[model samples]
Target: MIVFDLECRRGQHRFEGWFRSSEDFARQEELGLLTCPNCGSADIGKALMAPHVGRKGNQMPVHAPSVPPPAAAPAPTTLPAPAPAAVAAPAVSSTPLPPEAMALMHKLARMQAEALKSSRFVGSSFADDARAMHYGEREAETIHGQTTIEEARELLDEGIAVAPLPFPVVPPEQAN
Candidate 1:
């Protein structure tokens, strides 16, 4: 698999896209499948990125490690207690979104909120819930939750329909 930095011309939003090959990316772009997650724009293209070059096989180490003489241990101070777990803030982009992009984002967020009104938030049990529903072990209904990419792929391999949300969801418990 190869990763490419993609940018949306409409919003100037940058994101990564993974593909089997360069041809795969081109095919997706031609088919209008490539889109910006932030502004839902289809005007996407590869972004400028520095090439990654590896050292030659016969090249020696750039910096050799030096060993120092062992010293006596003399420190035994009281350690500070660990801080409570806290939710991390989302990463802010260095560049601000265009006005049109911001407007579109707001509209998309509102649309997602409306669509999720009747859907259930299953938290981390998303994969299990989806599998159960798929296997007829539970009643099938609209559900949204968290799951690892590997788990999602497994579900898809099992013929269960699943899709990723365009935006991150705030858990009901974490919502004010």
Candidate 2:
């Protein structure tokens, strides 16, 4: 599976999309299957990403200096209180979502829950089951299950309809 950082042209919203290959991504885009989860926009495109090139196998690993560095002076026993502005500022790692976005996410989660109510969990046999239904070997029924990206791509190639859930589903056996 390959993951691409995708952006919605309409809202400039960025999200990750996993595909079996570049061709699979192109096929989905051409078929208008790609959409922005945040804005519901169909104008999705790959966002610029930095390549993750690893070091050559023959390259030697860098080692730290064996000698310890000189010790620094001790910190003061007591420090001045932080300013009110600093205390009010949000942390770099914990940006809060806007109220509207939070509401939309909640609504989406509810919708997914409602849809899953009628769908049966087929576990890891999703591809086989879907193929069986599509080829008339089995009766048609709603099913949701875990399958690899390659399996999903194969199913799509075979004209079997399958889609990823917006939110991950806990398998019934694993659910609390």
Candidate 3:
């Protein structure tokens, strides 16, 4: 017996059919007796054959045919869901504002101006004036002026009630 790989011209479905010889396949095809089992197509022809297997004494041997590789893979059927709600929030700063916070500092300097209108401009004499007021050598009054951190520290060490203003005050001579 001989086997032929046959394909349907209409649906291109391929399968194998047994015959007495290669001539038998040709004779069946010429007689229009060949049909595709998959799509019932009668327009059939011999499919391309792979390398033949070993033969017997004046006879042919049959072997299981190889399967064709897939033309395309199937699409995925499912998708993942959204995550849970237990995520932690991020932390932010908790420190006090600096002495140079722009608009707020400008507003604070204006408030200091109003407060100092009834006070005095001691210029760089801030440490001396503050000490004199602390010792009762001068009348106690609101004052704003320039002083280094060292001067502020000395005044504070001497038990003066001096507090560093939140903004630098421009001297009257430096005003625009």
lDDT of 3 by residue, 1-176 (tens): 88777777998777777788888777878887777777776798877989676767888666768866576966567876532211012235587678666667779879877887887788999889888888899898887787889999988887886777765677888889
Q: Which run of 10 residues does model 2 get worst, by summed lDDT?
A: 82-91
**Between which residue pairs do clashes occur in model 3?**
none
Best-matching candidate per TM-score: 2
Q: What is the full ranking by lDDT, best candidate first?
A: 2, 1, 3
Evaluate model 1: give its lDDT.
0.83
Per-model TM-score, in order, reads 0.46, 0.48, 0.38
Q: Which residue pairs does candidate 1 place in steric collision?
A: none
**Candidates 2 and 3 compared by TM-score, better number:** 2
Q: Candidate 2 has what TM-score? A: 0.48
Two-way lDDT contest, 1 vs 2, winner: 2
- Overall lDDT per candidate, in order of appearance: 0.83, 0.83, 0.75
Candidate 2 displacement at residue 67 in angstroms: 33
lDDT (Cα, tens digit) per residue for candidate 2, span 89-167: 1236587899999999999999999999999999999999999999999999999999999999999998889999989
